[model samples]
Target: MRLRKVMLVFKKDWLEIKRNHEVILPMIIIPLILSIGFPLVFIVGITMVPESASSMEDLENMIRNLPEHERNALSQMTPLQASIYLFTLYFLAPLFLIIPVMVSSVIAADSFAGEKERKTIEALLATPISDSELLLGKVMVSFVPSFMITVISFIAYSILVNILSFTMLGRFLFPNLLWIMLIFCLSPAMAFASICLTVIISAKVKGFREAQQISGMLLLPIIALMLGQIAGIIMLGPVIIGVLTLSIILIDYAVLSLSVRAFKREEILQKLI
Candidate 1:
């Protein structure tokens, strides 16, 4: 209920997070790779490969394997062009989702577990703040940084891709409606879901590494979605993305509600006994 107390907790966490290189490095490095490095490589590689090197038969055979809808979607583009769009744009969307999820998970995994590891949980719990305030503060600490990183990464990615491919595509081709929706609508929910699950696991686990390792399991579904997209089985249209966003929102709500219910200072205190 008290904003001041929440802000104090948030500020404390922020300071600690900045001092932790293990957390800070991955947060920076992964986004750079996902948003900048990979796209640069894919776009540059596609443009460098001679179109003459690939046969029409080869292109057609590859396109034939795609579903009818997918085939129609890329019907106008050459194989190399299609590969460029697919790799730099469509395929990277789900993979980029991993950035926020990982960022949130790493931080949330440190929420209570790190406190326990440092023998600081007792002091934190002894502070004059309600459990809800404590939880909210921790949630914000994880969610805000992760969300900002996701947004910044997406913007950087959009600029990198559009500028890099402008000559080839003839216009700004990055940030399609689906991607915009994915970033604005689905990403927060996904981050919240990861953080909530990680916090819950952190409270139950004994060490930061264990909590982080357990929370890493949240990426399995994301990896599966990435694979499905690669296989052309999952097309991320507005309708599909809307459904995905809704599903993630629901899951986030469920996990957060359960986490709050399960979060008892007594329980955590007993674990330390």
Candidate 2:
């Protein structure tokens, strides 16, 4: 019964989403700018900036710019040293992860409030599914696609980052193990966290626009994280990043629980008028 109900709701929601250009356009545009266009543009700009045979123009002017023969010899350096270089390269890809998580959050935040705005909540509440089932179905609908898109975007961004960095630096510089952990592992947790939290916000808000504005406020931390990464203030190693991912995942679970508990059909119906 629960499975059928969930699928039924999912199908309905999917159809509705397909008809919403505001939702679809943002989902596509955010990744296009952050994952593909920005990285490609940045790489082109980086390559165009004339670097001497041995000078990197980043990080207090600290990018490795050794002679070609000298750089080839550094290949035999300690693993720790190599990891540091990889981490630096990985910094270029943070926008890819950050944008998708944020975009997902915004979408999730809109789901409930959007229904309220459209005056469709009363009908949704009148559906036979229990409140918990309905909430879970909505969550699954919002989260699953956002998470999948984020994963795919990361893969595409990694490929773009790699190709660009190699073309410019003559070596595959981005997407080290730390980045892999951050992008693939931590990113989904953060995405789900954002989605669940924003959905909770949506349920309480009056209109989709209001919910989106409020939800967008949550992105400040994400922006700060990206800026910090760019400024080289916070380096997320595998151990530290693993802890971060676990923390966000735990937060997501907690929010999911709260969303279900607080998601009363009565409230939705009460707000319908």
TM, every model: 0.90, 0.82
lDDT tens digits, residues 109-146, model 2? 66789888888787888878987777777777777777
Candidate 1 residue 96 C-alpha distance from true site, Å? 2.1
Model 1: colliding residue pairs: none
Q: Cα-based RMSD of the predictions, in order?
A: 2.8, 5.1
What's the lDDT for all of these models?
A: 0.82, 0.68
Top candidate by lDDT: 1
Tell me the spans in candidate 1 whose CA falls farther than 4 Å from its real position: 51-73
